[model samples]
Target: PTLTAGTVKGNTAGAFGYKNTITTDNSYVVGSNSTISADNGMVLGNSATVTGANGLALGNNTKVANDNAVAIGNGSETAAAG
Candidate 1:
């Protein structure tokens, strides 16, 4: 199951701002504009992005761009670990 819980008021993307999320199986995005593009990935903060399988991004603007990577701080990014 997929779940997204948040407010998108005044966001440029509007209610549709919750795009690009959970494209793969078992992925989850819990905030506005967060994205989880890989299987088993998770993005739990506003505008966070996770593009790698098993990756996790937990703060605003955080990004986990590589497989098995994790980013836990606001605006933090994980290096490509391929």
Candidate 2:
């Protein structure tokens, strides 16, 4: 079952923050303005985003845009899969 705790979208669980969104199953997002758009993605921190399957983004302004990618720390971005 999906468990959403704040303003969010999609079939996901453990989302808890304002304006956070998860667009695929098995995704989790936390922090304001965060978004996860792929399956098995996880994002944490303000303005973090995950756009690829099995991606992870952590810290403020972090982004992971490729499958199996991970981005951590503020202003981090992943450009290739790992």
* TM-score top scorer: 2
Question: Model 2 residue 54 lDDT?
Answer: 93
Model 1 clashing residue pairs (backbone): none
Question: Model 2: which ten-residue window has the lowest total lDDT?
Answer: 1-10
Per-residue lDDT of 1-82 in model 1, one digit per residue for the tens?
Answer: 3234433222122222354455566666666777666778767788887788889888899989899999998999998644
Model 1: lDDT to the true structure: 0.69
Task: Report how far off residue 63 is in candidate 2 (Å).
Answer: 0.9
The collision pairs in model 2 are none
- The most accurate candidate by lDDT is 2
RMSD of each candidate relative to the true structure: 7.3, 2.9
Query: Cα deviation in Å at residue 23, candidate 1?
Result: 0.9
